[model samples]
Target: MSSDPGEPARRALERARQSIQKIHQAAIRHRDPSLHEIADEMSEVALILGHDAGPVQDWRPCPVCGAEPGSHCIQRPGHEMVNGMHPERSRL
Candidate 1:
């Protein structure tokens, strides 16, 4: 299915949240609590999804350093464009 750039990222975030919720429910059913680990995993997933989403609003924080927005955090440059290709074109 074709989707806008932001659409796919949002979908990924939704999927990650759904997966986390399922894990929570499974934990409850199995009587084995691993909520902390589940939460950590969710956070990691969300962070990755957010990065993939790109700069929607503004550069909030340095994803690597977790520094506050507007702080002098080192920013990793986005992917370089291939010759004759538009900036939005995906290499994938």
Candidate 2:
């Protein structure tokens, strides 16, 4: 039987979605004490999605304290660390 024209496009889209999902999962798995690394990875993914190609060089720093991208400002508690804190904080 001949294949439908739409089938290839649908399959490609599905594969792309799965690939993005896997990347997001890996980024989650690589969470760290400061989460700077994970944030960078997520930023790269966002760039792939046509979102802001950031955190841009000219992006405004955190106005309250001038914190820059990748800076682990004490005021900005990392989501990954917060989730893993209870038992892992000591190990980190």
Candidate 3:
């Protein structure tokens, strides 16, 4: 029924990693007792709030066939497009 007073802030920071780093840093710097816990929480938070992997540019090249940047992954021979898969960072 009752949650830790810091729970709300922690939860918020967990979801607010990308946009609120400075705020999280300031808060974390001031709080020493739970420094480890905060560090751990922020690690997970960064992953959760990090890059937008859903975009095509975020995908990796197809292991089945080497493709060019901004190009569709072709499962060659028949040359089928793997629409489900996008490329990772561009080669450049």
Best by TM-score: 1
Following a full C-alpha superposition, what root-mean-square deviation does model 1 have from the true structure?
13.3
The model with the greater TM-score, 1 or 3, is 1
In the range 1-92, model 3's lDDT, one tens digit per residue, is 44689787666654654434443344445644244335335455555766222222222334446543234565556444434332233221
For model 1, the stretches where C-alpha displacement exceeds 4 angstroms are: 1-3, 44-92
User: What clash pairs does model 1 have?
Assistant: none
Clashes of each: 0, 0, 4
Candidate 3, residue 26: how far the Cα is off, in Å: 34
Per-model RMSD to reference: 13.3, 12.0, 13.0
Q: Give the TM-score of candidate 2.
A: 0.34
Tell how far residue 69 is off in model 1, in angstroms.
34
* Model 3 stretches astray by more than 4 angstroms: 1-46, 50-53, 57-59, 77-92
For residues 1-92, what per-residue lDDT tens digits would candidate 1 score against the true structure?
77576888678767766665555455545655465245445555656655332221111323444433223443335633234222332111
How far is 14's C-alpha from truth in model 2 (Å)? 0.2
